[model samples]
Target: MYKKIRFLTILIFALIITAVLSTGFIYSISITNAPSKNSTSIVKDKGSENKAVNTKIKKLDSNSYNILVMGDSLARGTGDESNRGFANDFSSLWRAKAKKPIKVINIAVNGDVSSGLLNIVKDQQNLQYIQDSNMIFISIGGNEIKNFRSTDASSSVVQPNNEKAVQNSYLKNLENIFKLIRSKNQNSIVAFIGLYNPFGDDLTADKLELLNEWNYKTEDLVSSYDNAVYIPTYDLFKYNSQNYLAADNFHPNSAGYEAISKRIFESLKNFKN
Candidate 1:
């Protein structure tokens, strides 16, 4: 009877050891099958890394285009917000799509006339920029006409006969302007921003006719050069003059500048290689 009891006690101890081993094996299997929080975190981090790499590549691709702007108050961004003018917008637009870097040289001044610009371009420093530029923007003749009309009458009404001398002078100066730019860089694309009527409904019939004549003359001048183009801005503010004009009712507002930039950007498509 004592021997039988000893054998039974040994069997009970063996069963206890087997139960502990079985429980440990089950726990190990559960851990091996489940997804870990750390693994998910690693995947998210890799996705972010890929996005950063793509952005870097885009920046690298956009570093080679150059632009030059020569005009009056409009090019200087007098009434636009932050003075980030059309030149700036044009460069940014090109960079975004062309994926290439761009350089902008805007030498436009407020109240500048075409004659004054002709003299400015004669300077060696300015000539260097003209030669280096791939594109050139010009906005003139407005100050020439407006300043001339203002001296004779305080009224915004522009008469055809009133601007005869100024108009003649403007056409000559503009011709010289194109000649000067082409002399430096024959390959640079030139874009002339035509004058817009700021008087809205208050504009006189004579003034409208004068503006149309000026635009036509400028377009004719631009046609003389292979690389030059004329961009008309008269209709943009014709009916919506008040909304697009700044507080002075002369310069374009921020929204108006944006519209001009969009037009310029559209023209750029023609020159793309």
Candidate 2:
């Protein structure tokens, strides 16, 4: 009886996956169809020009594959006014570049950080949708610090003044996530985008210092992962804060997010091998 029940459960799970995976299919098609240049954000003066940067999936022998990109508001495409966000732009570029289709499943929420991401992935529904991904991208850790800062006595900039200590715990969360992904798909490649400074002149110099410090540490932690590539956005956004940040002063705008996608695309485009 137990065996029969388990079989029925598996059958039901299969049906649900088939029903909900259409969006992912359409989403992949959208990415493959976008212009490669469409993902860049360039600024120019006189003869100078500036542009920003810009994934995939399929079967063992297929021409295409699926990639799952997960993270916080950055991944949600918050900074851009167009609301199309960098994720879509990146996918569009993939469509334009790859001989085969590349589907991207983006699971980034507005305020997700490390723990938040862990919490979300633990949920069976969301995890189910991401299982077959050919690769995964994570841009977490921005929202985690706010928890301690909200009522704490420390007027510290990024978090508890001792960020290295906090990162130790955060790294564990990253490890667990990768483990889960491996369990679901042994062949999947993973990349984690490092954090960037949201604070500019608006922040107290001390706060800015802390922000940079954290961004640096984020890249460090990301590097230690075997299956991960750390894509840096701190400088991309920091070089000019006002222009990069959204109206809210925290996230990146269309141009800013576009720059991030470019960085990510450059970092992992070699995954086809």
Candidate 3:
């Protein structure tokens, strides 16, 4: 009876040991498979860090200016010897006076017409620029007028019917351009550079009249928008045609662009008030 009791005690002890060992093994496996507290914290911290970086990259300061320049050869600064078109010059002038940060995105195409510019602005990249910009400058309509002048040498004659059709089409394109710009960015200040008569020296009376009419209509359109302004180049080049005109006799030279830059800078002053 003593031996049997001793054997029973031994058996029970072995069973308890086995149970404890099994439990310890299971716990070890669980610890090995589960994610560590430190690792989880690291992952969350990395995600938050990325979010902060993105936020910083996306937000612009209040004093920052992003300028978007669009339209034709004039916008491209094609005739300027220094290659800094009116847009760049204007940017420099603004930077000097405002002493603030500026970014200029000039997507102006040489010889681009209003219709062409409309197509360009429709592009995704340009739309993104337009959305980001606070100041927008457009130099168009000159190519359209030039095309008309080229085809009809008798434009000097008062052909109201034909001229009316051309004007209508041009105005329609301008309306669409303005609508597209305002759709993407409503609060941005828009400045439309008006057409100048390059043929002033030759006394192209009919061209002058047409340009004046076009500018008048354009200014009217500009007035419709509270934040939009028409920067008239007609008067700038009209009296000083010899000095402002480039060798091409169409686009403005460096000096001419400087004058335009000054005018644009001055015009922006009114907005501050």
Query: Which numbered prediction scores highest in TM-score against the true structure?
Result: 3
Tens-place lDDT per residue, model 1, 128-197, is 7787777888999888765533323654434446577678888998888888888888998888898898
Off by over 4 Å in 2: 1-64, 146-165, 204-209
Per-model TM-score, in order, reads 0.71, 0.65, 0.72
Instruction: Report how far off residue 15 is in candidate 2 (Å).
Output: 53
- Tens-place lDDT per residue, model 3, 1-273, is 999999999999999999999999999999999988776332235447654444332433456788889999999998999999998899887876555688888889998877788899888667777777888999988877764454355754346676777788878888988888888888888998988888764545666677788889989998898799999888898798899989999899999999998888888876741
Which has the better lDDT: candidate 2, or candidate 3?
A: 3
Residue 269 of candidate 1: its Cα lDDT? Answer: 73
Cα lDDT tens digits, model 2, 181-232, are 7666666667676666665554555545655666666677656656667777
TM-score-superior candidate, 1 or 2: 1
lDDT of 3 at 250: 89
Off by over 4 Å in 1: 1-63, 96-99, 148-162
Q: In candidate 2, residue 217 scores what lDDT? A: 66
lDDT computed for candidate 3: 0.82
Clashes of each: 7, 20, 0
